[model samples]
Target: MGRHDDETETSYITVPSFFKCPISLDVMTSPVSLCTGVTYDRASIQRWLDGGNNTCPATMQLLKTQDLVPNLTLQRLIKLWSDSSGPGSSPILNPPSGTKVPTKEEVNESLNRLMTTLSRDDDVRIEILTRIVRFLKDSDTNREFLKKKKTEFITLLVGIIRMKTTTKKKMELVLMATKILDTIKPDRETLSNLMLNDDGGDCLTAMLLAIRRGDQDSKIEAVRVLDWISYDARSKLLVAEHDGVLTETIKLINVTDSDPSLIEASLSFLITISKSKRVGSKLIAAKVISKIKDILMTTEMTSVSVTEKSLKLLETLSSKREGRAEMCGEDNGRCVEGVVNKLLKVSTAATEHAVTILWCLCYVFREGTAAVERSNGVTKLLVVIQSNCSVMVRQMAKDLIKVLKINSSALSAYETKTTHIMPF
Candidate 1:
């Protein structure tokens, strides 16, 4: 029962990418069970196969002797092994057992079938490709499989990007391709070459173009990809290498007829880029700062959500003392005063988002309150806080009141003495 499969028999497990150990590809081998009771690795499985008896990876079911013929289809298995062993050879031991071993040509034929189906709008094709991609991810033989198909895979992805199709199908393919790219970390040099080709920027640039022209959801997905890339330190630098793309993206946010959600996505991308100090400064230098200021000051931006995002961008910009000073000073007034005035105006907005905007303004004011007061901003803040009816607005007033401290006795003693005076 304990006889290891690889003891004398050539184990069918493909050699791992970085190792030479004969591993199981049918089910996991040498699996370790975690504290959470999830098992991994194939050989560690406790069940013994009677000739072909293999345990289920999940349920540990004692599979029938006939079931051990790698769960892959005969055509797929043959192609996999044939490709591994080279011309006119079997890669794995397949002694009948009712499991047909696929020939290399058959595997190629199957892939051609998949591609044909992909061109059609059949759900079966979509499911098949998804399953194939997932199986490739799970199998031990995938490295070799991918090596042979890398060029075809890249072309397929570019085709998916270019296909004129329903948004749902387009997004599904995009997401699936994204997952594949993440899993494979494909050859960067090759990908870069494609990006430079007239047709190369197909997927990446397609995402950007979709965001610029497509509906809100499309734009959101596009930004999500941008955010993912920006999160990578190397990708952040690559984004900056694009000539004037960042500036153009920021300008899109200012479009009066642009999708509000798209604007939010654009701001989110900018925020991600801003996290990198070098890129943040470059964004500011690109004159995106002036555009952002114009949006923040627009009375026409009545969408509370839009205004909140504007405030968020402003908050990020003002996070640095230098950025704050540059912003406030650029408008021909002291930084703190101008900021305080904007906060006061927006604090009265009827939407909940206004509260967030006020909070950020107050945060900046707290940091630069001294600079603001020196520029005569205290009276402005006090005027809003003292008279504003919204409780939150009133609270902001009280908080800033402490910072301004214009006649402390009048504020503190007036409340106490007025508490006892009766109109009757």
Candidate 2:
């Protein structure tokens, strides 16, 4: 939604607070009044009832009945507010009504009409795309119908994105197209087709453009689409080969002010792309290791999923010599120390990857072997062996300890001293 007003006038337009559903915190499409005198979205309240919650979400009071009284008057007023488009008022698209699911024939006709208009008029194309996005968002049936024409739909959306237009209306069209494509989630076959075609590359280029120039919502959608494409191995390499793809992704990860979803998407893409040795080297050259270390050091990165991903990427990067060198400090040993500390602190998967990284450092790089000794990593490796870790992890820890004991006589003395106290 938006606001429109004359430059000389002082007018503020906003959504009425009461129009929002308390449960969902979004504008209520089907308003229902409970016995608690609280109005909520019908679907949200139904889900609450289905979850066996007899208490109201807002008031925390027991409900006399699960019956939802439709607030027809309030619904009419909300509809009127949404439809009132004028100066200082923005048009809010209403969610699809439950009773108004379009049939297959109607959907096909609309798709045909949209394709026909897309080539001639950008404004009309945007309007059609808005209606399509609303339909796809509100009704699963509409989405299923569109899935039948997935290739055609993706082709049209890519065309819209490739079209050169700097006008606000055209950008809106591109944003809507991107949103619709994300929602549709084209199948693997369709995605493969897009990749094989030159237009597919253009589609990727357009998404990258959106990432650089579009708003947060558009940027998030673009990232998601790229994530989808990166699912397949060939597609992942294709994306990695595209110029500025990895660079933009690393930049997105380093962005201090970004949505968590954006960061997660970038991390997901990196994890996927890191599977390739060539791309892994490129990522290390992009300073992805330092970026990941910074992310791991952040207190806000508390999600186990994010931690696991970061560790996974680090493990991949550590496979390369340059990656290992970057993670292994010159003489201070902070880089290797930071990784060795994660041995038993994080989740099991994270611990496994952490150990894997330390293993790479100790065995792959000669400097890493000495650095671990100086950072007291041998003590941590002994602790890992004694701790309740997996068979594979324990074995890896044992292997590293053996190598350390054979290579560094000081580690051998430390092991002998602690062997009785902490048996391995």
Candidate 3:
């Protein structure tokens, strides 16, 4: 006879049975993981069963105590049963012994139980969602499942994003959602309504703020989303309609340190608007040139990598005709001079940053030949070429020296010709 109900409770927490074994599917006998934390150990179950009670130690399910058998026989049966099954079978379960049986109803029941657990609690939801997303990566049919649940998935992700809680949890959810969204390949038609139905100016503003709030990973993800929206053709056209987007991007670069990815993204966004003179004018009017100058001139003697990238970006900025005009013009010329002085100083002092600085100098001189001549930039550059240790920097410096000399000769010939042809 079964033990007293209270006895069963204690035994349930302690023993294992045939039902708990592979025979009846209670607690696993000697649970061993085939993959991840999922297990199929019959020994643990058999040990519990060996304790004289036939109850699943894990779930408290009753089992056939009479079916006690050695581990070798169970292993043999497991191999024989699995071998008889068809090409496809559950990775966790061994094949059936007597016949190939379908468990559609049982599988669905287990999934229903899991779904209930997932929906009833936030922690359970996050855990379940994490596992399912990982499983989806392995399953070919997950695409179909995702297509069917696209709206639901997006809604769930939006809910998580909106949830007010710890930053870590929020970031975890963000990463999960981004991975799933990428896998599912959700259409813009979905996010467009939530992210773009507004003028999108507000959405852009909010994303920028979120980017600054979290740590590196969160900010990187945030930047990805912003870059997606910022560079989208439709959004790009729409953003171009208002000057605020360009102004905000320029401001972001100015305030944020030299993040190469962000700088590159901002530069790309700037490139998109450069197609239109009005957009370019708006970018210029927003003081992009001055800010770029500031970035280029920063001589904090800290964060050399950032300074290197800033120098490269400065070269890019100063190369543009509009950029050069702004650089050589009244209010901004001093900024350019400051940038040149820093590049020269770093060239002599910092071997590594020196090469980059010299490379950028070459780019600036090459692109802004007229501006360099007007600003008398050649003499300073020549001094660096004569003394710098970095070979590339010296080479670039020498190149600029050659260009300045050639221009000087051309200017002299023109002047001499003009003098000889006086009164013509």
Candidate 4:
């Protein structure tokens, strides 16, 4: 463990993005949340406010209430994570051995209490829900025990969320509910009822609200819930048909200083929804192509997982003619160049996805040859043909070379054997 003191600090753990102060980008000393649902280190925000700034540093929203509530749950989470990682982890964070889980009765009572506590302050409700989310996240046993009461909890949560309430009063509750549903992973039939015509789409509507107005956690959970909801065949169309779901999700990608986890969730959700052909044109209409290019072009902001998924999503979108045209035609050479760049740069999965995309554009469609040639894609293709890549990838690389009308005889210098025949 790295030494920790009052002012300067260093640590081995890769601190969670949210754990760091927005202004300082260091692990928060005393984390606090503002009215806008953004959290920051006490000293950093205090300095910001002392500098005569009236807007939130993160959202730039005009300050309505400058009240800074101590984010006790977050503080505890940080401590728990720190303790767990820094050599002397508490039993709660990393249990020594498994023990008996809570009985069904105890779980039911807790759900019933949350259901009946309408008059309870929002703070209490959030705290209770936070503990539950943390507990569920800790291990599989906690999750499995809670799974038995998943239906009751979901029903109660639905009722609580559906109440006539103002946005400010209910956002936390709704967000927590979304997180719970996302964690518990309710059955497809249950999600279909809540997200589709059968149940008036209340849950789905709340998801949009979370995406639009919620804090970072809420936004991530919202997309996560939608990602799960999209898995049900009926809900995929509902998600696509919803006027704002696709638009709002695309908006998440463009937020200034956007969280990578949120973007990852958004990309995953888009991938799931993109499986249906009906949403392909709509996604293109919403400028998803440009947004994805922005992701691929910036290797710094994205994680390897994000890179892999982006390529996969791009490949999925390539199945549409408009998607292909947008990438190879309207985008000049950037799109093809990005694909070529990933040929040997990323993982095996990413390389696989990239070659498939290149093949579609340069070979199958025959419209991307100029773009590929401009990108020196032939060089990348030749490299792929000679790499220790999958057999399918090697063949696709050669086919792409032929499409560009490049001579394959040059392979003799690189490959000892004919690519047309097997190598021992």
Candidate 5:
């Protein structure tokens, strides 16, 4: 009777297809992740393991470790979903579960449902899109399933942002639309075509509008979408061709007291897009250098990722003669002073990027030597050579030492205890 009741209650919105376990094909109240990245209900996986199975029933791959990490994100999403649906929402069973990943049939069913719901009002669209974002973010399997139907999803999402709706639900649906595209993410081929295709399915245009929309979260997702596309050199160039793209991105980076994560995303997009000289010129013209310097010098930059990215952007800018000139500023090389101060203090990656920036300005350009000296860059470079830094970084430091004229003769007095100038 209890089993029969559980099956009959399936007509309720207990699960959204993705919340099902592969082993029992049952609703997952407690989704746990395996080393192979598959999620299963706790009881089902425990039963499977106790039954002498050492493989993930979903992928049939050998289990690297038996420990099951709680899929807290999925669990929370499931909870939020159930809470929002209440007890009287539309019919939805534990949805469908599949081996390895969601079956093609199951994914098609979900997307088909999405298409229908999207045709409704903005309130409905926002809820469904939010759920979809959660699903995409929940697991690699969900995204893998969506990637197969990227074009349809992209078109549908782009259409939502392009819609002239006045319902104005929370998150505005447009933001959620951008988030969906950010998560599912059009591949390089799809990105390139979106730029070329003119049939009103222009994701690039939607992103441009999202940036202009000025909603902080939406703009971040919008920038991320552009950043993903710009990872490819050709696409980077293609993105640079769009009007106001660099300007808008720089605006994001230059904002005051902005969210740290948003700044990181904006910087990442800028870094990828600035790969070409033309784009670099545009970014430089937009005063991206001083703005980045301000960010590095002003913000606490507790996030190592943000700090590394900031230095890298500066380093990328340094590659251009104009950039090198900007970094080796006329303002007594304050920019150079900043880069030199970062050496050996941050992560290896950051230290490496700082070293490269210093190498370019102080060595290749030979313009920031005075500032490097002022910042005690010579002392740091000596330590860098002696530290367990990367071979390339250590060598760069060595070259910078030579280029900065920190030879034995100059350091003779500092190392009076030794006949040879050890540091130099």
Candidate 6:
């Protein structure tokens, strides 16, 4: 009771007696029950057990065991009560009823009505599309149903996006369609059809516009669709041919407040586009090099997928003279430092790409060789060779080390470090 007295004296807001933990006398976020039939917040009880006490705080009854059973029903009721009540001591309202899941037939009917309404009137089209989007968000089964009819949905979506409607409702319809298409992931043939539209591929144009003007969620969906489309070589070329696709994609990378998923989609699209040398050069021209380097140096890039995609794109870009020059030319040496730091720090895929970037720099550009040697890149490469890297990576590391040894005298200082020596 000593702790209860201190807690009660400190709390200004009056908590319901049942809602307070018996041990801490505070409202519980996670309530659990002891074997003695007394409830306490999980953390408070855990602390009590850790302190070697085996008695219930409320009843002082001996507890047979320390195991805590979660009170899920109570937790939900507490959350509901907290949400409804307020400082003025208002009465708590009952939680709303859960929406029932729509059946597959109902989902199909909604889609049919949506397609039919598109031909009827603008108001009907917008309302139906909104309902469809809500249904799509309801469950994965609804999304899979839409995927089964991907051809029909893709055609309709492409047509709606191609129409030059600028009304707010029309724009909302376009955004919803984009989100649904992204969820369905139409096959390569369907995507090819979108690119081959008679209106000279207006679908890609519409997506670019969405990336530029839509809200964050819409923009994310647009980029995800674009990423899926870019899986095909022809589709990749079509996307790169668009004027703003590359620029807007890099802009998304630099967006400070974007969700991690959005940046991931943007990075994925860039990784696909970077497969083409022509498009890779365009990315370089758009100042993508510095932006990618910035991502590597900052703490924001914590997702391993993001780091891997960025590294893969860097590998592709580094194969070009322009990319190598830009990376080696950074005033603060972050580009080289970032690649070197990832030598064995990230996943195997990332490490391979990082080594490929270093290889390109060391062999393709004369200035690159000197810059890398100066950045302690040779030491990192040697570490990779000695570590438990894949055969391909170890070979690449050895090849880079040979290039360094042949090109510069700086490697001689670390000659004794090569325990797993490679034959020339």
Q: TM-score of each candidate?
A: 0.43, 0.66, 0.42, 0.69, 0.67, 0.69
Candidate 1 per-residue C-alpha lDDT over 349-412 given as tens digits, one digit per residue, 9 for 90 to 100: 5222333333444543544555556655556555654554455545544555565556666466
Full-model lDDT, candidate 5: 0.71
lDDT tens digits, residue span 102-163, model 2: 33543564577666522244544654565577678767877876776857778877678766
Q: Could you tell me the C-alpha RMSD of candidate 1 in Å? A: 18.1
List lDDT for all candidates, in order: 0.50, 0.70, 0.49, 0.73, 0.71, 0.71
Estimate the lDDT of model 6. 0.71
Write candidate 5's Cα lDDT for 264-357 as tens digits. Answer: 9999988888878788988988888887777666646447787789898888888888887777765677878877777778788888888888
lDDT score, residue 88, model 5? 55
Candidate structures ordered by TM-score, highest first: 4, 6, 5, 2, 1, 3
Best by TM-score: 4
For lDDT, the strongest prediction is 4
| lDDT string, candidate 6, 1-424, tens digits | 1113454432233446678665443578899999987888898778767756777755667888878999988899888777664575443221122222334554565567556522344544664565567667787877777778857777887778776646776676677778877777778667666755663367777788789889888899989887777766767788887877888888888736666778788998888888888888899989998887876777654578877888888888887888877888876557877777777777888888887788667754544676567768877887886677666667667678787775545444444433443221
| Arranged by lDDT, best first | 4, 6, 5, 2, 1, 3
Query: Model 2, residue 338: displacement in angstroms?
Result: 3.1
Runs in model 1 with CA error above 4 Å? 1-203, 211-217, 232-235, 334-380, 383-405, 410-424
lDDT of model number 2: 0.70
Lowest-sum lDDT 10-residue window in model 3: 415-424
Could you give me the TM-score of model 3 versus the true structure?
Answer: 0.42
Error of 2 at 303 (Å): 2.1
Instruction: Please give the RMSD to the true structure for each candidate, in Å.
Output: 18.1, 16.8, 15.3, 13.9, 15.7, 19.3
Clash counts per candidate, in order, are 13, 0, 14, 0, 2, 0
Better of 1 and 3 by lDDT: 1
Pairs of colliding residues, candidate 4: none
Q: Give the worst 10-residue stretch by lDDT in candidate 4.
A: 93-102
Q: Residue 222's C-alpha lDDT in candidate 6? A: 89
